[model samples]
Target: MASFRVKGGLKLKGEIIPQGAKNEALQVICAVLLSPEDITIDKIPDIRDVNKLIELLSDMGVTVRKNGPESYTFNAAAIDLDFLETQDFLDKASALRGSVMILGPLLARFGTGKLSKPGGDKIGRRRMDTHFTGFQKLGATFRYDKKKEIYHIDGSDLRGCYMLLDEASVTGTANIIMAAVMAKGKTTIYNAACEPYIQQLCGMLNRMGAKISGVGSNLLQIEGVGYLAGTTHTLLPDMIEIGSFIGLAAMTQSEITIKQVQADKLGIIPEIFRRMGIKLDIIGDDIHVPSQKHYEIETFIDGSILTIADAIWPGFTPDLLSIVLVTATQAKGTVLVHQKMFESRLFFVDKLIDMGAQIILCDPHRATVIGLDRKYPLRGIRMTSPDIRAGVALLIAAMSAEGTSVIDNVEQIDRGYQFIDKRLNALGASIERID
Candidate 1:
């Protein structure tokens, strides 16, 4: 496994061109199954999850070719659906939760899909009940063999129906929408996840001649078409990475500019950072964070203690909350971070506490951070990465600390971030990849 050894107390300064959004790229690549012609996607991140999906597609007889570093051409016209039942296919499909997205398109186009249980960060109990229930509502039958962990789906023609998801799951909504795009009638999905990734999926589907409305809202209307054509599309910038860079610049007291941020897609990310007294200037599509001595946490409206919490769409992303919590440790105030989405996500704060940060882990889901405000820079320490977001959070914490630190289990970081070490190096971070 690869590890990162970072020398701390370095002020990172330079411009970083963010890579494509991993979430969007996953869904977009899976959409290729809906067409018989070649589909070219530009700016796709070369991350582990994407590569796994590419391997899965290739195993199913889909022709996948990498035309460039971040570009791919997919031709799924000759895919063999029978491979979905193999053990090798199941092993690859279980690597990431995003693998379940292929189910919708495969079932829609070929009338059958077999997949194993999907695996991802063990944050909480991620249920596929919503996905199966939605598919059943749209004229599909589901059969599960628990012993084998294989799910079999079959249907003659998908018929549109009104679907109210149990929860606004990001991948579940994408799956349902992909199935609905080629159904027999109109599918109205209420309480849909309308995050930027979903918005981009909807836009791409529209470009491919699928009629979809309510692109950026909780309600989506999709008119089923007989067939979808292939089209070239460029992905949006990674907003989560942008938020991570913002936290890195703030904690390290660095002046950095993030290029091609797609400010229109950052719903309330900037405002959330502003609450922590982090100033950001948007130069066109670029986000610039100026160097500062320290940051102050803003309190609530009645001068009471403030708390930052995450919710569904239109609210703060739970993925970025870890970075926010770590960033608050070096700020000038106290704030309670409530990560309601995942129970085990807040457990990483113990590592920060080991590094001399004053953190009160209330429970499995909450933590109270008392900022040092430059009184004490976090001292270097050895830590293990728990997951993708927490791994990046630890990297930021290590970069802002004094002396040296070692981070083990970097595979978790590589699963999501594309060429993270190279990107951070461009920003002048003193980090080296050691195997």
Candidate 2:
């Protein structure tokens, strides 16, 4: 129950090297359980979710060796299946939604996996039907114990089969892919999630001797291999953090350089922000945001108002919508911020409204932000951080507001970000974390 005491209106200036992809790292770390050999992963972010998954692995008796500050080697040869059935394991694993990914590797390696209902951000209704359905199609038996609220999956005779997913769920596709890698026959997953994270996982699994084809595409074909050997993989820069930084710099009107950004992989994020009338100078692999005195949203070609909504891959990421919505507060024109993936994500706009923002929450999924154009500076107030993305948005709001703001629930922010306070402090942001 910690809070951040932030002094607003400081123009932070400096360079920030984005952390490793948190979402990608989660999937890749779980893929280590697919192989019994030495699997080395580099550029791992030291965040709460990653650490929680690693702790879950350690508790399950996996051999975890820290090679350096941002590297680790995992060997799943001695994973204890008996530990997975205990209440102690459920208590720890249920706290993190990433723990659900372990089902695939565990079922693939040990022929059985057990899990309690996983917990994560309450942004919307995140269904597990896609994951369970994919597993059932792979010749596995899935049983639910409603009394204990546990899912029991037994893949004793798991045989690969062709199936199409109803939705392209990132984590669900990853879980199925991990399980299919060691199955007895060929497995084809149509309508799979082909994000950079899933592609990286497939690439790493391929390097480890799994036969996977059509990478970076929704139609994935995997030929089951008897076993997978160990391999080393390095994660790309966190694109979410990069976008967050872009919004942060614009909100505070600061000049900041983001170093080592994988610019090519960040599809449409920079462009989406540009539509909001913010300028971005891409110097080689870095993105530089200059101090802006004014920014205005652009209308559509037909003279209609601009609408920015989230969708699947090759579309604007849902994670960055919160930041984008917050950045639109000081803009000169109105824009519709549509969050289609999650239902309750736009509820955080009420907090922004309290800070003197001109926002109209149309419904659960859409909000129209009328730009204040800095006519009146926002007055900071006490607020609570709801989820990871919303928490960062509030932090950005607090940093650009006129007065001091106290944001409670720092734990929600820490779950996804890696030493955010310490890192932002280096860039001249006055955020004091109090316990």
TM-score per candidate, in order?
Answer: 0.98, 0.99
Off by over 4 Å in 1: none
Tens digits of per-residue lDDT for model 2 on 1-435? 899999999999999999999999999999988888999999999999999999999889889999998999999888888898788999988899999999998888889999999999999899999999998999889889998889999987788999999999999999999999999999999999989999899999999999999999999999999889999999999999999999999889999999999899898999999999999998999999999988899999998989999888988899999999999999899999999899999999999999999999999999999999989777899999999999999999999999999999989999989999999999999999999
Best by TM-score: 2
List runs of model 2 lying over 4 Å from the truth: none
Report the Cα lDDT for residue 105, model 2.
86
lDDT of candidate 1 over 19-101, digit per residue (tens): 89988888998999999989899999888888888888888898988899999899988988778767888988988788999
